[model samples]
Target chain A: MINEEINEIQNIEIRLFLEALFQRYDYDFRNYSQAHIKRRILHRMNLNNFKNISEMQHRILYDPSFVQQILLDLSINVTEMYRDPSFYAAVRKEVIPILKTYPFIKTWHAGCSTGEEVYSMAILMREEGLLNRSQIYATDFNHKVLKIAKEGIYPIDQIKDYTTNYQKSGGKESFSSYYDANYNSVIIDSSLKKNIVFADHNLVTDSVFAEVNLIICRNVLIYFNRELQDKVIKLFLDSLAPGGILCLGSKENLQYSTHFEMFSVIDAHEKIYRKEYRH
Target chain B: MIEQKSFPIYKPLAIVIGTSAGGVEALTKIFIGLRAGFSIPILVVQHISPSSDSYLPKHLNRLTTVSVNEAIDKTSIEEFNAYLAPPNYHMLVEEDRTISLTVDEKVSYARPSIDVLFETASRAYGRNLLGVIMTGANADGASGSKLLREMGGFLVVQDPKSAHISTMPEAALQLAGADYVTNLEGIIEFLNQLK
Candidate 1:
């Protein structure tokens, strides 16, 4: 058979695997970018010592344990505290003033990954004296990451990178003050942990949980296909209170989003936007 | 190497190019010689610093007849356009022919990995894909080119003596075994003749 015919057959098998995954487990990855999803599946297949995607799918249908591994593979766990320092700096300079005007603020960090950015935002709010009045909801589809994020314990080696990022983002206090260093890991200060809620929320399947004042779902939407991106952006628009600030990943934009007109750009470079008030 | 049998007769659907160390200059020369009316989509992974700007695409677009762009997430591949993978993301081609960017772990100490692009493009376009490995310091593209060849895709490597950095092409020649090993000028001549 020509390569095109083989490719077409392989595509069908992958869709079947994804469909079976959705029907068997409620984890809906159907709308995720097909290319990325395939890469992850292929990677997972290699890791599990399986030869092809069909073999992986066969096991996925029968083996519950294998499904868990696939879940972790599919959800990208790559993140760091204060990732892209300029993004945090923009949050401090551009968004903080508007946030300061509010009496009480509710911020949602959707797809919070392992909660590095959640802690980053909390620290920023604390420095601005907004933490006392703010409630941060950090959510991710992977509870494994959510648990790690809730504990706020990161490896000791990563602290240097996090420290440099913190200082670059205009951190007020010493970076060391925020975490208690154990032998191998540094536990984030319990004081900073206050007023933060870490929960399981799937951006693909879950609906709006709260009408937040500031929504920071950075770098998460890039994994979704354009159709899913549009749907999630609409969810963000629905979840935001009028004039609420929405911050996406540095590479993500609202240009193609149908709800593009609903938000005015606050910092075009940082991908910060504010919801337009209803007429 | 310029023999009739060496050239692919099946109207190539996509062109995948990989380069690293001296890619900008080498790719510039290759693209400058590319005339208008070539319709196959070009996907490129030029190793760059994660923090670098979109200057490469903008600069290449100025010198080339085909429009060049930094690949955007979920953008469909267009004929007569060259898409440069953005910094810090692995660019992959989907079965649907759309470009997908991932911030997954870096392969070969690079995120915009040529291996990732070539391997995924091979899966999408198969023998209809044209894979090129050019000047670079690392061996990132060797395995990818092998995958392309295994999938019955055409393979070419820049002649190592003519390359700015010989390690990449030399490694590809040793490991991937391309159908054609030619200089920049020869590569330009070959590409221009592709239907």
Candidate 2:
């Protein structure tokens, strides 16, 4: 058979796998980026010796333990503290002042993978004395990562990179003050942890849990197709208070989004936008 | 000044080009063959500095009729345009003909990896894809070219003797024998003739 026919068949199989995953488990990855999902599925198939996607799908439907592996694989967890330091610096300069205007702040970190970004934002807010008045809701569909995020412990070696990023992002206090090193890992201080709440919320399947003032869902949206991206953006719009700020990953944009005109650009290069106060 | 026999007869729906080192100059030369009438979408993976701004697409736009763009995640690929994988991310093509960018670790010691682009393009486009390797300082495209040919796609290598740096084309040639071996002008002529 021709490769295109083979490719078409493989495509159908992948869709069935995703469909099976959604039907069997509650997680819905059907709307995720086709390229991203295919790459991750193929990687898992190669790793686990599944001859085809159907084999993987059968395992997914039958094996709860196997589904867990696929769930973790599908999640885009390659995040770090203060990723793209300039983004955080831009946030400090552009968004923080707007954040300062609010008397009582609530921020949502959607897809807060492993909670690095949640903690990173907490540190930024704490440095600015906003933590006392702030309540941060950090959510992800994967509870395994949420548990880790709630615990707030990361390997000690990553501290150097996080410190450098913090210093670059206009951090005022010593980066060391945020965490305590215990042998192999560093635990985030209670001061930084007090106002944050980590919970399981699927951007794909769940509705807004709270009306937030600043919604920071970075890099995560890039994993979804344009339709899903727009749907999630609309969700952010509905979830945010008027004039709330939305920050997306560097590679993502609103140009193709149907709801494009709702948010005016604050810093175009930083991918930061503020929702218009007008209804 | 070229024989009809020199060019491959197969028409490709898409073209995937990999280059580094002298990539900007090399791609500019290849793009000169692009007329407003040329329709196949050109997907490129150029080894740009990690910290560098994604200026190559804009820089190359001035010289070609094709709209050259830095690839944005989840964007659909269009014909008569060139998309360069943005800096610091690996670009892949989906079955639905959209582009996806990833930060999942670098392969072949490069992000915006040539191997990643070629491999994914091979899957998406199959035999209807044309894989081109030009002057570069690294061997990033070798295995990808091999897979491209194995999947029934055509491979074109810039003649190493004429290349600014031969490491890339030579690597591709050594691993995946070229369907056509030509210099800059020959490549341009070949591109100009594409339907």
Candidate 3:
């Protein structure tokens, strides 16, 4: 069909644009899942009033500001406080006991958009009397989102959902005790932010920088192609200490990863896995 | 004659449906009557709570002869199956005839937004796409339905008067001006006519 042909042409243009972006900016999105990237590009096209991918490709090559805008659109920043409460419940019941054994705990919340989950983790640790011994590294590739994450503030309207998730996740204290409300926004308690370090780190381009006891990278790998996902999994494996725990989004699994055997499934429903030590 | 003129006769490569509020009941009526050997892929975005388990596909699968499943990210789409967008994610169609899922911020206060699916599928299928907006409480599908029509895709809406929650269909009719406005049974008859 003529429509199919047109789509194919658009696909080629999109690939070329991605390549040009990498060659010029060193932001390697070449291995991201194509369908997701394409959708983002199409969404960008509609917003910028471009007729086709070819036109967008031209602008990407010629305009720096346009490329930056596209980069923001391409990044998936959807997240919430205590997302998947059951996962947190599993963490409280299963993973935290192992974490308590460590003299000093190191946790990496990779792709920590706006740091909600990071704060959630800190609150959980605080309640368990482990906050003093834990250092949480919250990293994301998008500096724009990273800046917001460092602020420890969120819209007041979303607090209701966060509160429900907290109770579901077995919170010992009232959710209101954690934040100070300022009309439209809630500033997360300053103590909750004390142990968290927010930084810009791209899973695609960056190498493992720290050996951690637990790594929580949820819903981020779904955006990556299989090859890139394998690479990132390898990176996580290298970064994790022996017997370290890895928690993924409910929908994500290590089924296709080459390193699947290296990790023992801790809680299947929660998608929590523990790195196995070689005899 | 006027109705015939409005409903353009053309074979569509795929059908994209968006609904909310009373989507489960409305979708059941449409799927229950679908005859076997239907070939077009049906991608749907039915607004649901983020924490809710995906029971829609399973429920619909029992009622229809055609296969129905929750769409996975980055999978190639196949005809003869209805792919429902999973909770807390937006489902999109890509140029390679594959499904893409995103956790982007909620549009129109919803993830798995009807507008997101319709907008992307319209681009991928172009004039070969058939966009159907059904019973719901919000205006979420209106802009996306408009986009699909702009891309030359056929647009259809459930008659607002007959919809369980009329606002969604009414919005689609007001904003996109569908080629056909019919009740549930009338929409089923129209679908059966597609080759």
- Number of the top-ranking candidate, with lDDT as the measure: 1
| Candidate 1 global TM-score | 0.94
lDDT tens digits, residues A1-279, model 2?
776676678789999999998888888999887877877888888998889899999888988998778888998687889988899999889988988988999999999989888999998988787999999999988988999999999999999989998898888999998899999999998778888988889999999789999999888887888889899999999998999999998888988899989999999988999999998
Give the better candidate number (1 or 2) by TM-score.
1
Candidate 3 off by > 4 Å = A1-13, A42-68, A182-184, A256-261, B1-13, B36-39, B149-152, B192-195
On the 0 to 100 scale, the lDDT of residue B26 in model 3 is 88
Report per-candidate TM-score of chain A alone: 0.97, 0.98, 0.97
Which of candidates 1 and 3 reaches a greater TM-score? 1
Positional deviation of residue A240's Cα in model 1 after best superposition, in angstroms = 0.5
- Choose 1 or 3, whichever is better by lDDT: 1
lDDT: worst 10-residue window of model 1 chain B = B1-10
In Å, residue A21's CA in model 2 sits off its true spot by 0.8
What does candidate 1's lDDT look like per residue over A1-279, in tens digits? Answer: 776676677678889999989999999999888878877787777776887778888898999887778888888888999988989999999999999999999999999988999999999999999999998999998888999999999999999999999999999999998999999999999988889998889889989989999999987888888899999999999999999999998778898889999999999988999999983
Q: How displaced is residue A129 in candidate 3, in Å?
A: 2.8
TM-score of each: 0.94, 0.92, 0.86
Chain B TM-score, candidates in order: 0.96, 0.94, 0.96
Residue A210's lDDT in candidate 1 = 93
Query: Which pairs of residues clash in candidate 2, taking residues 3 or more apart in a chain or in different chains?
Result: none
Worst 10 residues of 2 chain A by lDDT: A1-10
DockQ comparisons of all candidates to the true complex = 0.62, 0.57, 0.34
* Alpha-carbon lDDT, every model: 0.89, 0.87, 0.88
- Stretches of candidate 2 exceeding 4 Å from the true structure: A182-184, B1-6, B32-39, B161-167
